[model samples]
Target: MDRVEKQAALFNLPETIVPHSVLALGYPAEENKEPRESRYEENRVHFEKW
Candidate 1:
């Protein structure tokens, strides 16, 4: 909190608007590679009925 506050204060930015909660961040790691699946083909809904 202290570090973030100090940095925000230096920039003269509002504490309320300062992004304190990081949504997502991480180092790159090996992931299982796979072909992309089709969404429209599987979950198709007609205009008046499925």
Candidate 2:
């Protein structure tokens, strides 16, 4: 996060661009893990869409 200039240069990106966050994606190391559950309310989810 501190070295913005170096990061951009390393990836050959333009200096004008700025990165706000980093996302690391990968699958779980173990298989058959139970998924966590969450309650879904129509009003909480849809907001003004409905």
Candidate 3:
């Protein structure tokens, strides 16, 4: 077992793990500055007939 697993066993906690690739591919670390309303408006497409 690794250090993390060893620590979890010591503290009686489950070993929750995330892959490094996932961490790299996830959202940016910086805070999102764009307003939600504007973003939704910009991305939305109105369907004339559905």
Candidate 4:
């Protein structure tokens, strides 16, 4: 998150600890179970061109 220092304090992290990133997981909401379109696109791939 943008506020790493504040977040660290919430978890009781020591001041000396240097945090780069944080991982958070949670249960999905039931309403969000609907199908979604594919994000993959062939044009986005690159072989050797500019």
TM-score of each: 0.32, 0.42, 0.26, 0.36
Give the Å shift of residue 12 in candidate 2: 0.9
Per-model C-alpha RMSD: 14.2, 10.4, 14.9, 12.4
Whole-model lDDT per candidate: 0.54, 0.58, 0.45, 0.63
Model 4 TM-score relative to the real fold: 0.36
After superposing candidate 1 on the true structure, give the runs of residues whose Cα lies further than 4 Å from its correct spot. 19-50
Residue lDDT tens for model 4, 7-28? 6675666677656765674657
Error of 2 at 36 (Å): 12
* Minimal lDDT window, size 10, model 3: 17-26
The order by descending TM-score is: 2, 4, 1, 3
Model 2 C-alpha RMSD vs. true structure (Å) is 10.4
Instruction: Highest TM-score: give the candidate number.
Output: 2
Q: Which ten residues in a row have the lowest lDDT in candidate 1?
A: 41-50
Ranked by TM-score, the better of candidates 3 and 4 is 4
Instruction: Name the candidate, 1 or 2, with the larger TM-score value.
Output: 2
Span of ten consecutive residues with least summed lDDT in model 4: 41-50
Error of 1 at 46 (Å): 47
